[model samples]
Target: MCWKTLLCCSLWLLLLKSNENLAFKIPSIDFEMLHELGFEVSIPDEPGMQRVFYMLQIDDNCPALMDYITESNNGSWISRQKTSLQNNDKLQISVLVQYNDEIYEKSETRVIINARLLTTRDGRSQSITYPNGEGECHAYLSPQKQAKRCKPAQSIVSSSRQTCQGELLFEDNFSEAQLNRSTWKHDIRQRMYHVEEELVAFDDAPRNSYVKEGYLHIVPIVASEVVEGSFKLGDRCTAVESPEQECNIAQGSFYSIKPPVFSAQIHTRDSFSFKYGKIVVRAKLPKGDWLFPYVMLQPVSTYAETHYAKQLRVAYARGNSHLQSNQQEDISGSHLYGGMVVWPHGRAMQYLKDRLSKAHYGDSFHNYTMIWQRDKITLMVDEEIYGELYEGLSFFNEKCFIIFGVTVGGFLNFDDSVLAKDVKPYLNREPRAALSFWQQRDTWAPTWGKHSSMIIDYVRVYAE
Candidate 1:
């Protein structure tokens, strides 16, 4: 180091070490503005010549207290930890300032933490316990079901002294101007899902899906509107298997063309995927023949990402209104369905929990809930139990992410022979299924008015 710089640094340290004539100011605790578990330790602005450090130590009698140190941030220091301080405890904070390699203890300040809290070695409700009786206390917390004092309304874990059960894990209200891409990633591809072969292109275009007026609106549109001739998804498609086949389509014939309709599919696979939990969705079903809206799940594995593991449709609804089965039963948009795909004895099977309502699910908003356990799955609508499956979840041991989408004319979901009086437009085995659906859009497109949009008010997933 240069002689002049070294001499000035040494003099600065020596000046701060002196008790009677200090060069810089020491920090003080702002107990009056203290957080539940933090002391507002701050120091005044120091000159630009050299840096000053504030290191604080709690009294040894203070249980689980840890030391905190910080250089001034914009001329101040404020910090909080995930700990609690009991009420009416006299907290003695020893203030120290460090310059270069030297730390000098300036003075000690005594203040009451709060009126109702106290430090206790025993893990008591409303009592904070810190090991070693020093600096910060973040170790032990009570398991009570009540809220704690001085806790901010928004917190992840240990918001207060109380324990947590059925914590809300994830939620979205779609109140923003655009879809939360971080939370709900758009899967831009055509008929590439593990289950069901839909004659639809799931695009990332805002016309197919977007957030508006506090609701997530997923609308089914004609593919020709987005792409007139041969379609290619290019970089927007995330299909891992057969990217060329899954993400592109060439005009085959006048009647047989690219995926007949355009739609949207989004998922939480990138953001959130869990094994067992409770999921609730407030949504208005879509209206139109063969329009399928579902909140689905898939395991977070490459094999399951394609077609190898069991899946869960937390909730699903068909968009055909006034359709009936050949057995003289209602099989249309008025019913809600959810099922679990299980693999047992080298075979894959699916069991469903279905509910029928007097009104079309597309007519208004309804709460569709799914409670998933290790060995059971339950479905509900507006607090009423719909149905459940009592199968063990032993097939997949990995966490699964959430998926919500609106697809049109899938082979498996729409049974052509099931509809009585031949309401179905095309057979499941027909190669030109997409063209057939689009040709008859004059009859079905009228059904998909603005009210027919799949409107999701919110989706909430809670810990089980």
Candidate 2:
């Protein structure tokens, strides 16, 4: 070996040594001890722009990867690198593997990094409760067995006297022959009934109905026997454009009674409406198999003349036409335009029997309450909140009145046999279903309170 040969051999040896150092090597990373394993992340070096990072490592030897595929272990497939890892200049790789490059029988380490910010507070924080007691009194109602946890409906009258000094903003007791003249008076114009285009007298209906037993009731019916099955109910304000339009009342027995009967409905449309306040009622509901009992609340200023046609058109255009169906499956028939209100204010209506399971409406007295505050309306049955109004987005700006009545032919529209079972305690015998079947089949027409009586225990309104 001469001098040149020695020099060449030395250079080759040095190059080989460098290559050995560059070959695949197991990576080492800091998992920060088990207690410090929580990871933190920020936008990679570039705050407002996008960035990427990369990692490099060798494989290791072990059994199949499944057993090692866990948060603590990486098994065979190792996480090599993330494009833009930033904390320290050096890449601190961390991972476990069983086999290396499919050749080495020993374990190998690999780079591992969190892709996004690691929020250690993932669902570990408590919810903040903002105390808001000045709004209104709230209660809940449900069809389940009488709820055990509930606030009772009290006489807010005395409290109001203390709160407002007995000015008597509104007050009513059932013993009077007529509603208190001081509070206000509302006249619900008689609904127009027509056969084809000719105006007809729905003689059975009474004019200027009154409140009794602390409940406002109305008897809406068509009297003449011949026009009984043929007449229709239409909105007076829009009757010209919608002559044949049917209201939302379902076709069935109003009460279990026969023809030549009366039904009642009295609303505070003109006299009064409340913006933010509490309305409470203590009474037993009528629960005929097909009876429909409802507590309807509307934006007094926004929708006094809202018609069924307008409601159906909007509901239909919004792709909710199933509301037209009186299928026995949907007991509330609320999906129908009847219950859909411009909310921030909505009404609560249900099949009387369906709500209390086997207990009919009149079986036991229930304390029903509604608390309207700002943009929220909470409905309570027996003091527990059961339903709510979260739409409309409007708060109560004006005062509204309460209408409590028993109507016939709601969602159930079942035969008289079923109806008889629901309101058994109140009505006489079962109605004749065969005579009403064809009448009930017409989906476009809904009839409420043909021959029913809605009694009331008490009605009270409060303001805080």
Which prediction has the highest lDDT against the true structure?
A: 1
What does candidate 2's lDDT look like per residue over 1-464, in tens digits? 22223224542232222222223333322222111112221111211111111112112211111111212222223222112221111222222221221111122222332212221212221211114443221211111122121112222332222322111234455667666545533322222221111111222133524666555444434333422343334443222333443232233435211222234444554555544456666654543333444445554443322332111001101011122223344323222212233322243222111122333344455666555555555555654555565554243344454544434432222223334243222222224332342244233123222223344566666552
Instruction: For each candidate in the order shown, give its overall lDDT on alpha carbons.
Output: 0.62, 0.32
Model 1 alpha-carbon drift over 4 Å, by segment: 1-164, 192-196, 225-228, 253-256, 302-309, 342-348
Q: In order, how many clashes per candidate?
A: 16, 52
Best by TM-score: 1
RMSD of each: 14.7, 24.4
lDDT of 1 by residue, 200-234 (tens): 77888889898888999888886544226777788
Which runs in model 2 stand beyond 4 Å of their true positions?
Answer: 1-169, 181-224, 228-262, 302-305, 308-340, 343-358, 388-392, 395-399, 410-452
lDDT of 1 at 59: 38
